[model samples]
Target: MVRTACRPRWSAVVGKPFSAFPREVNEMIEQFFGPSAANGSTWFAPLSLWEEEGNFFVDVDLPGVAADAVEITVEKSQLKVAAERKAPEGERQYQHQERTFGRVERTLVLPESADPDSIEAELKDGVLHVKFGKRAEAQPKKIAVKST
Candidate 1:
């Protein structure tokens, strides 16, 4: 006889096991308990970073975020991206919720080669694209060899 493992239906409701709920749900529970509520919750904007051609690139996911709401800054060799996604106006009950709304931010350490002054950023289609150019001395240079 062969047997297979069985899982509960609620397990896939939030793309997680039933035993573990989403962060929002956990926050709600914590708020009701009134113990860790003062700690507050932290929201982060998902991002991807890569380097190519002596340049660094970053793409941050900012769904439901306005372009004007984002703020980017570089100081002390660190790049900071901060934004907020406001909650919908009016009161309404939600059957199932996964998306989070509030202040979202991400920070990354800039490499020595990165030129903070040459950094550029743009927000399009809910994605924040950032490019960091390398300093002239950091770029590769071709050395010609000659017969002596």
Candidate 2:
């Protein structure tokens, strides 16, 4: 059964035993606490973390958000990113408001090898690209062996 915002429909699975219990329970729970409330009213932007070469990359999704609204900082082994997304002005009617607005912060604990001083961030095409350079000692090194 389909569920509406005000009313939630429930259906029981008759084919399999105990199946209806789990499905019905989950459907009811999701009605009250859905994806929109996963992070509360103020939502957090999704970010991807990966390492390439000797640099660590953090890509944050901030579509429709301005660069000036974003703030980045590094302290010890922690990297913090904060931003706010405001809703457009002069709206007429709304069906569903999924986009998040307001202040959101995400702090990531970086590796010890990451150099806090060597950090850079850039916003382009609604994406915030952050790069952190690894210390020389942390980078992979090749050693040559001479024949004895």
* lDDT of candidates 1 onward, in order: 0.77, 0.78
Instruction: Give per-model CA RMSD.
Output: 8.9, 7.6
After best superposition, candidate 1 residue 110: deviation in angstroms?
0.9
lDDT string, candidate 2, 1-148, tens digits:
2334654355445776565564456455556886334444256577899988889999998887899999999887899888988877886476665555687777889988898889999999999999989998988899999999
Tens digit of per-residue lDDT, candidate 1, span 18-48: 5445544654555566423433434456788
lDDT of 1 at 34: 43
Q: In candidate 2, what residue range of length 10 has the lowest lDDT sum? A: 1-10
- Candidate 1 segments exceeding 4 Å error: 1-42
The best candidate by lDDT is 2
Which 10 successive residues of model 1 have the least lDDT summed? Answer: 1-10
